[model samples]
Target chain A: MATAVVARPVSRTQTRSREEEVLVWPDLVFIEFIAAMLFTITLFLLSFLVNAPLLDQANADVTPNPSKAPWYLLNLQELLLHMNAAMAGVIIPTIWLVIMGAFPYFDREQHGQGVWFGTEKAVRLTIVSAVVGFVGTWFLILWDSGKIAFFLHGWFGLSGGDSLRFLENVRSVQTQLPWPEWSRNITYSPVNIVIIGEDFQHLDFPAWLVEQGIPTMAMVGMSAMLIFSLWRVGWVVTRRDALIVLFSAFVAAYGVLTLTGTAFRGQGQELVFPWELKVSEGIPGQE
Target chain B: MTQMQPSAGAAARRIEHARQAEARKLSRRSFLRVSVFAGLTLSVGAMAAGFLGFFNLRKPTGFGGVITVVPARVPKAGEEPSRISEGKFWLSNLAGAQGDVAGVGGTGGILALYWKCPHLGCTVPWNPAFNGAAVNFPGIVGWFRCPCHGSTYSRAGIRVYGPAPRPMDTMAVSVNSDKSLNVNTGVITSGGPDNPLRAKPYSG
Candidate 1:
């Protein structure tokens, strides 16, 4: 059993004073309420100022040369412009979120005590990582554009100069049929994907089945397996929470995908269908 | 005597230790409050700087609003000039006008064309300036090319290549009775095969 002990003064005994402390809750509430209202009003004004630009109407028949996505998505669209779609669209966003969520877990530190950088080595590393991520992505995009232009001309035989000529020739000349007919069967076209089974498409599908499908399934399976590991992590450092991190990551990823499609892909532009091309040209020899 | 002295010393040490622990707890609390405020300030500052840098990138340059072109005297039937580059402004003749000049019941003869790439707002410079080497592009020459991004347009300003999403816009032209070309500021928008500005032989 523990006994209560009173402390005696080192010198002569001195009398102590007692005071009552009162918290001003009303004042705190008023300040908080004001702040929240001001924030809402500011955001409303800001949203009103940011008017979005609309492109010309979407037509399936007339494809615009070098069709571009909206400005907000220029970076991602630039990625799509240079790299493969799947890599730019899905894999990059997933990687970004995974790294961000796993950060504090990987960097456990007792040192950073009260400083914002918290004498914690992990906190400092996070700041550094964020800077690196931003600068690295910007530099990577700049380098990609210049390097990509070469491939456009050298390998693809598609120069910004030559593509116009190619389209005109392809449009006018008929060697049994137009180039679109020939390209229609080549099978990267979405028309084939919805119409025919995966096996029926002309491209290498067995490889897509093994490489893409299997890995995607494995990734989902691995996430399920990690639940126990994640639970254990959350159990420690009672202050550590997982729901906010996981949910935030999911929302970020979903936002990126939605923004990518909305900002980059034109809604009504269909690459398939030749009938739409029959608009209003003159009959040859009539003039 | 020895046991009494040791007990007395232990009591003194415990009192000192308790006082120090209380002091440490208070300091840690103060430090935490300051740190949170500082971290928030830094994060906000960084985000603001990032957005500012992204928004201020360089804008593109464009040419004068209007460009005009003139075809030769009387072109033979079915004969189109491969290139039209000489005087006031660079223009590529898109299509020949039908009918006779002075004869009644004639639809009037005036070359129909315009000179601007509807995409990216860049001037579609006529490439006829390039000699036969650049011409006869695979036995057939294209009309205009964009120096900025290599967008090519036919004599009709139809976007054939590069990043332009639509055909070139047409300058409104009024051929005076004297046969001199007068171009208006208005540009006729052309797109697809049905675009009213499309030239003959190319319209679907």
Candidate 2:
């Protein structure tokens, strides 16, 4: 016996009608217009309230006590105080930009499109990452600024003559490792090393590495841990979820750094209360 | 039956041969397309370079640009260095004896030094403490001290001590007809064995 197959025609209009979209003219255009107006008003208000600083005519002879970069670049300048200039100014930012560019390629899912914190799990992850970034960056700024370290030292009664001498000795000398000469030599190599002191006379490369690496590792490691934990716990089942956590963390870190640089840094680029800051001088009426 | 089988096998071979020929044609077309794209990219890059040159697009003013430090904010002789923000340098009016000591030649002797420290490029500030009796360089009236590093420079911008490889860099200084100071920051003389005072100082 032979069997015949039957073919039915499908309607093109029905399939075409499934696509739902709002008109760009009124829907998107009106929203854009409102956003532009809001932005302009905010800018006008800011300009009215604050005047641009104009310092005394360019004197080639004296530099201000703590010369700072423009506000937008202050984040990198803040980073410069803690880490190697090359890493702070170039490497880290370049890596972040590359990662941001590659994000779309890594997350190809369309389910989360046009949605803020697309899933419940993504919202939780973002909040956690943001908290981690904020606390981590703040801790680093305080520790590196010597506020916390000196406070702890003084609290522990280590500021006295003998205790201070012991602390100085501990800082000056490198701890001897039981490892072989080759291993020790490899460890001692100045790859991500810096020598900082009154004259950079000390050869404390390991300490410098550890000091600079803490904040960097904390930021990166916390984000990685969040992704890993989310994956293991089945919270982040997709690449988009992982990227959401990472990007949220990055935004938080950027905001924290900018805030710290703008408000916390004072004369000599030292950490100070916002009210105590004396760096902003030469504004028309501020003087 | 054998003849029919032979004909079927020949047809199969013909189909295979045709498929291979088609693949070769497709590959050749793709290669041509790639070469055209590469050529187009190179031409566009060349055009961009030519356009930039034609438009005289140049880098923004930096250390090497000649800048006018106006109003002649010259420090009194034996006074502290005057900070010139536009030029990003310090202009010091050295005493005649100090200018002679540094071999800097001028009737109204002045020296313009880049604010950057030679060791790590940190801004060096003049510390009045170095002139006090308690300091090691008590005889020196004032000295440049690097806050980042303990490098010190004498009144003449010579490296007195510390990790700084050499003395501070000096720029060419000349007085304009209007009595303004014209500093050729572009022509930087490195501090080494070269005489620091060789640049003609601005006299107004």
Candidate 3:
């Protein structure tokens, strides 16, 4: 027995492998339960702070000043103010969300992984385009609103002093314009049949036209840029096709927004020209 | 049996197998033993609190009562009634006559309906321009429209159009002898299409 004594040596790799611990299924469930409970309690507390029905009664005839929806819906309402409610409030949003949900299926790749851009370069580019489109839209709106204020207050006699004060007061509620007898007389005349509504039919346009030409051109330019960007992000098949579809879509959308601003906002007509300009920038017109 | 020689790998495998066997033999009796102890402790705590009537204040109990408002009559055929407010509620008395029985209350042919929609519980507004700006209904006939999902209801609390599943909720009303209105703030019964007081379908 004392003749032969042999011992096998331990390997460092084996020891290390044994030490590694992988999380099991139960651990994940516990974590998920904790997260859900925290989230629910947080929402319950926030509801109290915000005045909860959390509820309120809705009255349509007496529209609230700044007749805006809840904050999340404000974006949609804002769009409705510029574009047709059907388009801005319903169609575009539905299409946008559908397209977003479909993104993972169409671009199946594993390159970028956990990063914000995901794995596909094309997918990242598309994301950037969406961000740019959203931010561009908001930027254009602010620009248009500023330009509108300038043109209406400075160029057109319809918007200075008391008119602006009146406009501000009526911005949230539906307010009728204090149309002069002369304006009313011209409303029935056929000179501006293109502007059918009683409010826009009598707008004093020449006073604000020359300066407005710039914003008008800017609108066309911005619209062109949107087309180009959308095309670059794969909306169009070819350059020529991109040019045709984008220009057509922009014109049609702009026309719709302009019409909305013209009719719905008749009570606040002095702001019509600028309103159209803002409509060109994508703000929805509302009463 | 030949030499009784042992390998390190064999020894390690034997130890792991024994550990697994020990784990598999765990019994439901052991689990019950622990859970029963925990449950008993919780029950004891609850019983102690029960003995205390608990220092917690009892929730106040009361019967429903009326919230009153001045009388509002249907407006003259042409003029729209001014919007009236009673405490926390907003009243659009399109029927122009301002009578005494307006608040939570007694009736003078006054048709009062809560503005809140029964579907998803949103406040519905009367869009005079809903049937389009050209529609002649004006203020008298209009549906309560929910801005949230386009739920529409008639002034008589009936679901005329849109996604509303039932008629709007109605507050109890009582008109007193002094022409004052007493609206009992309780008794909100909202369900299905049938309403007790409505005479006919609201044309709006």
Ordered list by DockQ, greatest first: 2, 3, 1
- TM-score for the first chain in candidate 2 comes to 0.61
Task: Show the lowest summed lDDT stretch of 10 residues, model 1 chain A.
Answer: A278-287
**Candidate 1: global Cα-lDDT?**
0.40
- Candidate 2, B92-186: lDDT as tens digits: 77666553323335333677888777666877776644432112222556677654433556656765433455578888888677867778777
Model 1, span A63-118: residue lDDT tens: 23324455555445443422324554578657857867885776554454334533
Q: Superposing every Cα of model 2 onto the true structure, what RMSD results?
A: 16.9
Task: Judge candidate 3 at residue B30 and give its lDDT.
Answer: 88
Candidate 2 Cα misplacement greater than 4 A, ranges? A1-56, A155-219, A230-234, A280-287, B1-115, B118-122, B126-204
**DockQ for all candidate structures vs. native:** 0.02, 0.05, 0.03
Q: How many pairs collide in each candidate, listed in order?
A: 14, 14, 37
lDDT of 2 by residue, A183-230 (tens): 323443345444442223333344443334544676578778878987
- DockQ, Cα level, model 1: 0.02
Query: Distance from true position, residue A266, model 3, in Å?
Result: 11
Q: Give the Cα lDDT of each candidate.
A: 0.40, 0.63, 0.43
Per-residue error (Å), model 2, residue A31:
35
Candidate with better TM-score, 2 vs 3: 2
